[model samples]
Target: MKLQQQKYRLKLCQPAILPLAVLTALTASPILADETDAEKEKARVIEVIEVTATRQTENLQRVPIAVTALSGAELEQYQIQNLGQLEALVPNLNLHVGDAANAVVYIRGVGQLDSISFNDPGVGIYLDDVYLGRVQGAFLDVVDPQQIEVLRGPQGTLYGRNTIGGAVKFTSARPSETTEGYVSVLAGNYQQRGVKASLTGPLIDEQLAGRFAIAKSSRDGFSFNQYTGKNDYDKDSLTWRGSLLFTPVSEFTAYLVLDGSNQNPDYSRTPHRETPIYSLPSGDFLPVGEDPFVVNANFNDREELRTKGVALTLDYQLQQSTLKSITAYREMNYRTHLDLDGTPDASFGIYSYEDQDQLSQELQWLYRSESLSLVSGLFYFRENSWSLGGAIAPDFFVPLGNGVFFPFPVISAGLRDQTNTSYAVYSNMSWQLSEPLSITLGARWTSEKKQVSNSGEEFFGTGIDTPQGMQAVFGTGIGHSLTGYDASQRWNDFSPRAVLNYQYSSQTMLYSSVSKGFKSGGFNGRLTSFAQPYDPETLWSYEAGAKSLLLNQQLRLNTAFFYNDYKNFQLSRFSIDPDTGAFLSLFENSGKATTYGAELELQALLTDSLTLNMNLGYLNGGYDKLIGDFEQEVSDERELVNAPRWNGRLGLDYWFDLGSRGTLSVNAGASFKSKTYLTVSSSDLLAQPGFTLYDLYVNWQSQDERWQLNLFGKNLTDKRYRQHGFDLSASPGVQLGYYGDPRTYGLQLTYRYF
Candidate 1:
């Protein structure tokens, strides 16, 4: 579909609202004992949920924030294999995978656009309370997780910097006191195969315990490369984790976790079929196959990534409070080779590599009572990273007159060496003023220093050695020599939060809060000359929300309305000069912007065998002030990227007894999103139309819960949609896009032993 004339207008239909109102009404009604057994069964469908949104365990209905929590079973039921699947289950969230190893996660239209090593993500990712340093390795696959929590809006008070767009927390299951183990095998289309296993048992009676888990999955690419006769997006990965727990006494405990992963995958993109406007010297445009999955490429792009990490935690309980300490170390090695031009002519190719290591330590003190609660902590972090890469553009050689020709340069190489050190102190306190009224306050102070050294060489001209027996026709001059420079910077920030909550009844509560979020600034490692550093970005968020449970715990409803004011918003854009053919990118502090949105979550037991879950989100605000280079006023036309006007999901679940042998359950769901722009430039080439996708799952389990089987299908309707897009409309008039998976179906078999 062409995007030049596309329009996206919000549509609020009655069908979506009527069901939510009916669920709310059911929650408010009481269940009478005189009713039939079916009624009793419906009233008993409610399940209690707990979350650690505040760094402490609490009932979900008592938390005063917009959060979505999913258990391991629920994740499996929804076929949440990796982080990319999360967008379909959460509200106002969009996860776009840029490649096999990197992604861009947007919340309320705020997020990072670049995945370079030097820049940090606005949305933070954490595994078992340890922060993941880069998005390149943050696409963690779900492997026997205890729970997953997605917190919306600003969360700097507790999560600190890099959480201006919110945070995602994944908590793995700990060691069990009793022996247990489970294994599963799965097979699907496109030669897909997967196996996962986990075991937990006591090591020294009641004093020690251990747990171990492993997962291996491989699949052929959905798209086929006709030129190479190979799959274009294949994947093979393996991951393993182990944990040990020691309980020396009743008041003290220690836990350690070690994990590692290896991933090898092919490139994840195909060229567009549209013809480029720019004609080559032969007066012919590049030809791309009509099939969406086929591409004409000379290079077989690939990557290999390896990661390792370890975390240790200690806890000691006192008479009135508890003290805890956590230490973690992580390392990663990544390398990639890709065809940058996406053509069969071998116009240009790129090879990039990175090596990094990080360490962090944190200490916490917690005090809790009936009327007062407090949590305070100190954190220290350090990281060292290095990267090197080069782009080869052999097509630079152009023929002059007759048989004479100039062999332009071959490659442009660059490298980055950086070190970062940071420290912070944070505290959160809550006090009850009366039986139904309470107040909470939070503050965090952080300081950071970053040192960087960058060097590069542009081999743009010709070389001395040539078959034509001629001196250097163009380059090989002193100006092309590699040069290096050093840079350093320091930053400090203070974030605070205030909240007022009131308990209206035994089953309902209302809350309002104001908070500040921050993200530290850093150098742009990709730049070769006149490197400009961007300033920090900050946000102020105000929110009001309500949490309630009705119908004797059979129904749940939560809602929140939020508005955010952003200052010095950091925006990154890529530009390919038409005159020089140089690819340049810049990170700058854009003007101020504002956003307002609302979110709703509802879960209800509609009947004895039927349950309903739904989420709806709306956003309307955009950039109120902005400008392009040369001080051109572009405020009225620019908007935030990946921020759709409306997003929603509706799911229905049903279960029935299959005689005395087993039980069968079925799930059907649909998710929809409005049109969105992939970049801040708002170029027509980057626009994507609205789309809706459906999924289905069926499961059968034995009465004793020892054997199980599941059949699942995603994108059941065979809808085609783009997950990401790139703009190249200046003279080529051609745009490139990475597509989401097509229709896929699979079956899984499982067995458990105790």
Candidate 2:
């Protein structure tokens, strides 16, 4: 590690305010830039931010949509490492991590809370222009990114299906014509250490360029298991990306991107601190633990995830339009061993392993002229996935004779294979009817086919604790054999949109739109009997919004109000089967639901030295009607999972000249989230109380902008909060919660080489 070489010179107890003293001393020198240029730059707070929200590059202020754009510099200044922290900066956005491979995302009270292989997220995630087919490995770390864009609302017209909520787009920094890159090192508490380096430059003069970047980070866990004498949430990960840009002709360009990551970590969750409300099946009471970050598991739990992807993009510039093609392939392998009950005596556990592969191709033509602009595209996607898992009982429960214990799984074991193929054709057009007004129309036609194959066995018999019991469950011996199932289904849909935009002036615009979105239906292979495919989910969204820059470009404010009518909403739940009195995974279609919300974003240069940014979101979400399989109506007043009534952030950024030596910048933010439930089947055990988190950072840059030193603290108040929660009442009194990180402070040193 590079830090080892420099460790001797650094003191361990340096004051947190030492950076400020250094900045004060440097301020005695002359200013780096002229006064006029500085004044002009400070006044233009709007800063011509750009985005591809409309499938075309345009200024954010000029785009008639609800969008937020963040630059790489901005993300670094805020010390955001992954998508999970992004919720603090964007309204109505929630990101939860179940493991290194699975990221559950929600936008505007709409999202997929479950990480089931058969289901898809309502919000689409894209890298560059390639859509990610699965949530696995979606919570990728930031790596030399150029920009991140979030479009709030149904983007189905341009992005296709599964975008009823919204979309997130990430664009990486490209290789420059000249040699340029940076190297950074960070050290923090909990044995935290990380290294990130990137190199980009011309490989063949004006025709070709290449870029390569790599990042490695590791951190010790905070949660400790006394019985096992091991930490439960340790992390170790490495990620690398390489890209090449080829320009063989004056009007044509091709780019190839390859990226991969490997992660190994301990268990992701520990037992909840709240006492169990139900009695244990063993007639034992829940253990008492005053510390929130402690558990009593005795099993050996491990997790490993590997992901790789390749993408090729080509663009051709014609006389009147630009044609683009994208081809992508991705694969992931995820494996985990989990202790479900968290007690020293593990009543339940699981070993789950899954392998997935996906491929996609898309071609589009974009044309823009004086009075008309249009985008038309064709997209195709295919995916193959397989899962093998086993549910097991504790070794102590079924001990063998002669100091031995059963080695095989106890309850159930299964293997499942799934495949999906989808195709779509979409077009969006805008026509200028008047000097300051335009009407936009868009539609998408999609067809999809899905297939599922499942085979599994259940061990049942008195004294069935050995390999013979497994054979009996498979019917190879004396027990009843579980029947295997194979099924396929096809679906088609047409989603459409209409928008009206009025350009009040160059600095302001108003827009209103109505759009439709859809998600494909699939089979739930986990079920053992009479498994049926769920119906597709659909939603129609109506929204009105405004974007404006006021006070001589010193203040920017954007707001939007939206309402969605949803039908056949897909929901996943763990429910008790009346006949068996056992919990089972169930996928169902809710009859109807509705969500209405409003969002406000503001960016203002309160003074030349101080800036303010704020985001506020208010959501009202509930079911119009729903009936569970229990022959009873689920209450209509239940709020959506992960949907808080109120969520917002307030940020302050200040920068001052460190004179000729450098510049100093300081930023602080406070984020608040109201109480939220983690699952649609809201339970007292699944609810997360509202909490507030604060972050602070200070950066000092060298005069030439080649060196930067950053001091940062996250969750400064050391608030303990839950990122996710699960109700295992089926096991009688078991509740598990995945916790957010604790107060962490770190310093980073970065040097640019060009």
Candidate 3:
């Protein structure tokens, strides 16, 4: 097996800042751009520096940390609605859909890929300062983001759970003691449509204020089902956010935020690879009219996810220390059609499946000063899930003992109802020992347990068994297997992190840290005959980096190099079974992997009006050591699926004032990903070539900062590719999958009043 090599790319673009002539002409641009003379001076320094990278809000360049921040305006301008969008634009980070709202986010060569929610995320995703509890509902259809802060390296010290790789914080806009509102609309190809609205105003003068936002989008899916008739499939989604602000005293304030999202895709199941492709080299603009293979007709997979939460924060200022408390409650539900892949066949009989899930969580914390800071929190997560599956009668002459085959897909609908509970307590402290150095230390103890049950039919790959089949096979047992078994597994982790920082000067700092990460193990699906589950896996990272401002502030560079040692890496294994031409898969902890990577971010302000931003990420990753029990049907050494060794981005923006009436700005961004494996069996050769995507946006605002309009186009090059795919062995030669979308263009408008 060959290992993956290091790869990365960097491009140069014009600055995103405005030209001197334009800036000079815009002394009074759009209302939004026409900030107070004093306000303009402060913003000119850092473009609304973010606070998520570190625990405090300060000059971005002054923070001795590596981070990337996208403001609410930036997100709107770029149309970064989901994690997938972030992955395309950010370096090193990768997010792939796992069925529905379940997006697997891998960072710096570490992350979770399996469908089981029991596993922990190497990277943590946070909304409104609250940690998201599950992978299934983590990537909500989102909008109106205030700021998105991407902090590289281990953040286990403060963020606590599932922060082994790094952390992503999404801040939502809050209500102010004022009045404001906006509206946006988008229309495009494939019947794509989107609408968003936001309103915020005083309920009782300065004492109370409320803010609300709602967004909805739908588009006809690109895939076509031969059996479902012409023009099949389209995706639909909805997102909402609301906030309340109450501040009776100038020194004391309280913030409450409520947010949620829903997703329902017309086509949940992957199209069988044997199926047709849309717009091949022929540029037909439509998928082939007929199924190329006989097994492509049963395309039935469905999924729905709902996440709702409320977070409350209170802050108080005292003589010596400023105190803060954040409390939150959240509930998430996920349900999906059992067959993400096409059904076995009509002859296989009643091919059907479904899973229902519920998840809930809570967190709280407090912190003091930067020199002596303390943060502690309590977290509780619980989930209840159930799955039922059944399949049609099997086809005869499929090489079984009897010429008459029984319903093959399922002898009975597999049924499993499970309950899981996890709780953790964690704390962290950062201390400054002297003018030149500081240290941060933190740890968390987490415990989890689960219960599962199966009533009725067996698993598909459990080895077919029939009276005649068993007799023919020397009684190894008929395809029939039964179980009323209840299993429980529990474990605890003392996750820890420490970092030491040395300040060489006001503009630069060097830092090092050691951190650990883990993913819990749980039940595997029973699509076949019986059930299988694996053990938990763990990883430790040793890292060091430098944050600096060079070229007299013309350049801001931050880079980190890391060595990750993985133990029992959880991965899906596949092998061709004798009964079926297809490959079978079950999650297992196997092999040790060593990975090294570095991230480079450069922000340059060549002139007061022109600025350039570029980021590069390269990873030298492969399974350095591996030991496991598996059939010879698969290869051992290969690149991990969906992990691109290199990813990069370059962006440029130029701002201007149009004739003193409003502001005009233009920005362009491009992203590139090196070649990567789309499937586990890298040897079989189903991969995506390196692809680059480009985007551009132009905006104009009203004389009043209150009204603004934005025009955007994504994937200007119209790149075609697939992000992820999977195969199953129960049904011979049965492999189906999905791919990414094409270019999209739209316009949005907003109006603010205060």
Candidate 4:
């Protein structure tokens, strides 16, 4: 086996050295500003954040979990518009786009890479307390968000679904009683144009309220297609969300939310060829490219994705407790056409269609008292998903006797239909043993059942070109049945969590926790025949953390250390079919693994108008025992996929006060990540070297806070980096890579009224 040499030095300790040193110095130093009334009023102290990571609202600092919360204002300031842009803000979190319709997300180096309908995501995504059944629907634009929270480690007690790695929660803004609205317009390079608006007002006097928001964005393609004389990888999308709040009595309230998004982008999955042209054993050549943004593709079509959902939540407030119920229904439809070979001769192409829908219901009871707090919930979910796809490769060849080969075109089609149902009961309670100490215990019982029907056909030709030649091979040059299967699986798990907390001081807290998580198993939808189902994967995590407000509330620092034991690791990779010599993507149990990591977050108010924020993460560990295909023990030399050795971010924000006009603010930040492998095999050709990205933002607001203007730049240095890759050298003799967005600058204007 050959490994690619690292292009950059692996300064394993350099990335975290500066941040840790700075944090230590800041912790030892005194407050930078005096506590005078004017200074105190003008100073920007780290704001207190609220989160629902534990299935109940609580102070972020008080929550005994590893989590990060970002408010709407912070998101806007950071210029994060979608899920893929959030990789830099959070620790141990990785997100990227696999295709125009699928989002690949990973936390702590654990996640599902296959976009098959039968597989489940390791990192769960929830919007407005509704669990998204498919990752295709998880890439919607952020619109009118109240806050976004990322919970790290195993989240099995509260979020009982497939949250083995972690969970991400998105909370949208609720309807307000007062009448208010805002409109924003944006323009940038590459013919970028967008508009976003939101309005909230009282429908009836103190009885009803409503909120509506919409976002529309469009941008020219970044990649140039030589075959069509047009651009590829363009962006065009529209998303809208609406909600209504009803309150007949002060103790009773109901909220109904409706949301939808549509994305129609042109040829968004055209990956640039990364390998050199290769000559097959049959004397046929495969095309390749040198540039990452230039591609030659014979097939180009617009990809379409449509998603809609509705959720209703009801809450009844009592003297010391609250009872809440939520009901939600969501559905998605997606279609895509791609040229996999990246050539103009139609060497390889594919078309896919997906339809999915889900329904979920949840009930919760939250209770709070002077020395005790408790939260319990019941959840039920049902989903139906269907997928149809076809692939054609005319340059393929089949081997004959005596080292001879014949031209054999390969054509295949497949369909998968699956139904999944789940039920769970969970409860978490915290008891205050004393004024400064507490103990919490939580557990969840979950049962899931999955049923699937898969079928496919494959056709091979032996240099058959004419009508008579095709008639000799088969009646119609279509295909013969290659695969047909029906399967069902049932799984049950009992997850538990325990935490001990100690309030060391008024501004400092320490906590330790142990938790278990589970992910249900499923059959491979891309298989050539029926096979034994894989077993469920599970993880046990041990973590300790500290949350502190130091330097007299001018500085906030949070730190965590975690160790995890992962068993029955589910792995997805390409394997050659022994019978037909065709490439097949399948899933298997790859044995046990271990992962350990540390994270640190710091925020300091350097001066009355200046604030500094920084975060650093370190990860290490890999497979302890890996079982390869044919049940052979494989070497454990490859690094874990998507797990970088070092990652960090540093930023500064300063405000310049204009006496009578308004406030001018400048924000600058830089994010860096070490070498990362995109695939499970850890192929060097598909790896991303260490790189840093710099971003800047300048803002101006009117004195009345009703008018605002901003200018932002991303990837200021134009650092070229790969976001995803595919290695098909075994069959197609080609490697492909998808790159991150290049340098982009834009201006936005907004107006607000109340």
Candidate 5:
């Protein structure tokens, strides 16, 4: 249903419309929990084994690194699907601001903050060695996987660039040369429904093998928009993979992997989260019937996104070592028109973003031994993007005689053109001084550049009172409203790293490291007051950590402390271009800050049939000086915003052997997130507060490795919660944080052809 002209004033409708739409559709994140005996057989042996910490695959206890590993089994048992579920499995990790589908991942109390750009991320995401640039881009096409590893601390060593906040690596299930595949369907509350299946095995006997899979899910938004008539959100996805492994001789072999996926979601909304009339505050979960903000007036809205990519890898092994190479190309396009109607638009009419990311690269490496091993590689990346948005549309706030939306000074198109390129060479070496002592050394040199130009119309706001600042925003709209400003910068950086590792025993290890991390420079896509380019953000990191096994291998514990010195950090600022009411994103390199924190985790086999795990994280981070003299800068210094001060989680896993062929294994977990400021730069501390959430899951399997079943519950108590939000000032529009939904439950079943 179209929002009524009588209720939604122009300014009000401008901002809230898009945000509510997107937030609502994205509320649907992948969720599933079920297993058969064949799956159980694999799950029972070990939860997961990780290799991200060192490029070497070893038991979690033996790896000389600070790491958190989530097995495919653990992923399901907890019904922890996607990055959001990770809050409960990994220590000190939180997805603040945005919903489960769009997130800013934080680690060690420090992570990429306000780091949304066309070509950068404070942290890097790798899918088989191919980097996923934008943090938002990393959220889509999420697949039910084999395992995921969150490696903390500075990985400046051999992981490559943009890893200051560490890295997250996902390894999808590979094709088995000896067997085929299977399929499954799932149904749950909130109108959640899904279908998925895959196939693999011999195409030409022992000479070749391949696999392909597909999945789709949809659900009604927990935040109902009565004005829209339809439930607020839904997500649809599809993926495919094909592989060919060949062994021509006893000592020579090669493997090829081609895979990609697509995801479309229509969500974003606000349903009077809670009532001051009753509860009176922002952090509580309540049904629409019992709340105050549930009025049909305001809603979040956004139009589109499509992400797809393909990756290929080749591996060759000798008697004692392995060598590999990877090549990839991926593209993503996002086109959105947001009408921040309803709640509070302050008057900036429709704001929009139309951009696409096209990336390609070739990576090479070698690894032959665990001790006395060396790794080196080369990389190149390039991307192009465009955007059309502003507050210049005079049609906004203007009374609509009919049902047509007339922005104040419509900027039919706002464009920013940019080309980003980086070239790098890196090397890492390790040697064992003794069985108990080892030393690691690594270094990388990079040359990077970015050039940006603007070609479009300026609406009117005069950079003084708009999100883009006053001078550039608009009061009237017409012609090429943009100044053709272009800039290019070059950087040469040498990152050096060293690590000392000691094996106290077969069950324990200790390690310490020192390294430097870098995030390359980029053009400020938003309108800017100064003509200068933004400097690259850099970090010098120091860390010490330990891993150990206790109680006869019944428990595992890991912890780390880090001190980070950051300079010229890139921070996002919002202001209206005087020419338009639309918020203009401007950048300044004068940003500097320090982040220090601790991460601790423990997993215990409580009994012969029960086990438990707990994770905790803390951060003391903020800036030390004035970044610049912009109104937006005043708002940016508050607690570095999304980096919450505290985070923790608890998990319990239990298995009971039923009579004979039946067994019941139950896994449940709960997570706690401290009060977080979606827009930490805001002046009042009361604007944002701490919140807590809980979840649960269970699984049943036959004694054999063939049949399995899983039952799960998310937001089990229907805990009302908001993950992230934005409120643009000046004819300002307030897009409330996306809220976590009510109780959702489901059951899944699987069988294997082994």
Candidate 6:
């Protein structure tokens, strides 16, 4: 059956070769027909992108940092809907869905795997300049965005702590004076359906303007569950945003934004890949299959996620400076249930729930002069979060002689509460030293405090179905209520950055920089006993890069090389408690490591109607030392987690004019990644082999620009690959792997109202 499916996919791809060949031929010939010098010059000019990566508005090519900026139009053209879709467009970035509630993100081989409230994300996600405190809510939907900027390497100096990896900023579209709006509808395979709409207009003439956008989408599951006769890994979500811009006077403005999302989807399906023999009470062992999208589970798994946030931004423009203030509040509630064993025997299962809220305030002052630019800010953030849930193994059994067995059901419950607060002050200054040379200096001092309380109980005996049932068999049960522990810790650090930039020519720039990054330490939230707190992790990075525009602005090329000296790398591990014989998750600091890499990005307008773009990345280096209990198991020979040795993307887009009727566009792209390890131990069961994916899109628009249509196909070849994995063979006797989405084709239609 799998072979037949492969053959069918090959038949579907044969039609794409002709169009690709035509595009290639066009790239080698002149695209403009008998045009004057002025017309040709206008056709070759690339759009000038503006970015705020350095805390001030400036041309993207002039920034002394490694950054990738994508405009709203470009995002739409690429069909990017969320943060997970951005990995293919950027170099050295990796993102995937770890579970229903966690979106794992990695940049330049640095990120956090655990999503518990006590642990902070290594990569910072910012929405409209407001930082998201938890990784559980970082998988944001892109709704009416104005721009998205991905800054590579460490951003500790300006973004503050927990940014040792990098930072991603999503800037939403603000209210506009002109009245305009659009509505779009889409349909695809697997019962996929979606609708999106947006509107922007003035409420009080030139004084007040309001904008609103909403998106709702639903799709059938990707995997089939034989036990329940239902589909798994489905999608159902609704997201919306509203904003009001008040310009009381010409010099002052206040913007208030509100956003929310609700996602209720079927549980993620992690099918068994390789399984060890586990005899059931019936004297038979469960059999595992090769199919990745089929599961046999006894539990009806599900997940629910709801989030809301509000932010107010105030800006006051002075003669030579601007003062700004941002106040924001956000909250999230997430719950999920899983059948970890992926078998009908119901050997092991788990449920988790988390509730979190955060409040933040920031003030900034910007000063710009003829030869000098300065930006300074004060930031304060606080968060309160808690989690309550447990695991169950009601059908667990231990065998005796002569085919006899005894029920050994295991039930466990736990609760953890935590509070975090942070304060920081930062400043960045840039001065032009000569006609083509400039220097920049920045620094930030941050202090953070974390407090946590944990309590739990585990029972091992017969007739232990739930936590309440434990009391009935208290005397007979072999378990005890764990002693609760409360702890607090404080840490402070100073991160600094220095850069030198030289404008070699009007369209070329060269830069070199040195920066330091830091991530705070905290107690493990999933502990059965009191343990020492892990120490903080720090890194020093040195980088050099160049940005250039060639062929009279028709081509843009950027390249960078970086080396990092890492210390006290925080690593997560699972081990069995010697006292209680219970499995526990904990963190320990590894000794030292180093990483060096290089990246290249190119965008060229081969002709007036043809464009080509590519991005390539190469990474090397691993741990130089090891420590702790798992040292013998985890060796330095393993590659870094989510860090592929080589990754790249290539794309081509061409436009065709249809006289006065309409215009059509076609785009083709392919992305490839080398092998990657998903776990710190680099287990072979959790490693993803190298793979390549292809995509194609066709678009048409009416000459009046009021109607548009798009037909798109993703993963065109129906390639099979793993997005995430877990090695639970030691406990559950099953290796679980989550597969990526298969081939999907859809059509979208849009109508504009003005």
Residue 292 error, candidate 4, Å: 0.6
**Model 3 TM:** 0.82
Off by over 4 Å in 4: 1-36, 39-44, 160-162, 277-287, 397-406, 459-479
Off by over 4 Å in 1: 1-43, 160-162, 266-283, 287-290, 396-410, 459-479, 576-581, 730-734
> Which run of 10 residues does model 6 get worst, by summed lDDT?
1-10
Using all chains and alpha carbons, the TM-scores for the candidates as numbered come to: 0.89, 0.92, 0.82, 0.91, 0.82, 0.91
RMSD of each: 8.5, 5.7, 8.4, 8.2, 11.0, 6.1
In candidate 5, how many Å is residue 532 off? Answer: 5.1
Select the stronger candidate by lDDT from 5 and 6.
6
Error of 1 at 186 (Å): 0.6
Residues 1-754 of candidate 3: C-alpha lDDT, one tens digit per residue: 0001100000011112333344345545444434466643432333325465655665565454557776666566666667677775566888766644467788877777655454456678888777775677777565766778877666655663557667888888887666777776666566777887888888988888999999998877565665565333466889999898888887788888888877776655444452322211232222322341222344344556677877788877665455666677777666554333343333322332334343434444556664876666666666666545444333311313232222234334455677777777877777988988988887878787777765544434656433222224322333455544567778787888788988888878898888777666666654334546767667788888887877654567778788888777777645444655333445666667778888888777654445577889888877865543344322245676667888998987665545336656667888898987766656233467788999887666655566665666778877767666655323332344556666776665555555
Off by over 4 Å in 5: 1-48, 96-101, 113-116, 250-253, 266-302, 319-321, 341-346, 349-359, 369-371, 391-412, 458-480, 528-532, 576-584, 626-637, 683-688, 730-735
Write the residue-wise lDDT of candidate 6 on 1-754 in tens digits: 0011011110111122334454345434443435477765675666667899977889888998889988776666666767888888889988877754677888888888775667888788999988988888788877678889999888866663448888989999899999998888877878888888999999999999999999999889888888888888788999999999999899999999999999998765545555643656455667777677787776547688899999999999999899999999999998777777777765776767789999999998999998999888899999999886667777665434354544556677677789999998988889999999999998988899998887676775444655446434433435665546889999999999899999999999999999988888888777746845887888898999999987788888999999988888787765544444445566778667789999988888888767788999888888887664544534456667888988989998766655344556677999999998877757787788899999987766655777766667889899988777766543434577778788887777777788
Candidate 2: what lDDT? 0.76
- Model 2 lDDT per residue over 1-754, tens place: 0011111111111114556577566655666665576665654455667788998888887777788888777767776677777888888888767633478888887788767577777888888777877787787787778888888888877873447788988888888889998988887777778898999999999999999999998888878888778777787999999999999898999999999999887655555445543212454355557676887765437678899999999999998799999999999888776666666654566666778999999889999998999988998999999876656663323223343323333566666789999999999999999988999999999999999887776664434543324434454544344657888999999999999999998878899999998898988767745557898888899999999888877788899999999889888766665664455777888678888999999988777667788999998878888776575687554667888989999988766665466677667889999998876667655587899998887777776778887888888899988777666554334566767888888877888887
Residue 421 of candidate 5: its Cα lDDT?
A: 78
**How well does candidate 2 match the true structure in TM-score terms?**
0.92
- What order do candidates take by lDDT, descending? 4, 6, 2, 1, 3, 5
Q: Which model scores highest in lDDT?
A: 4
Worst 10 residues of 5 by lDDT: 5-14
> What shift in Å separates residue 420 of candidate 2 from its native position after superposition?
0.7
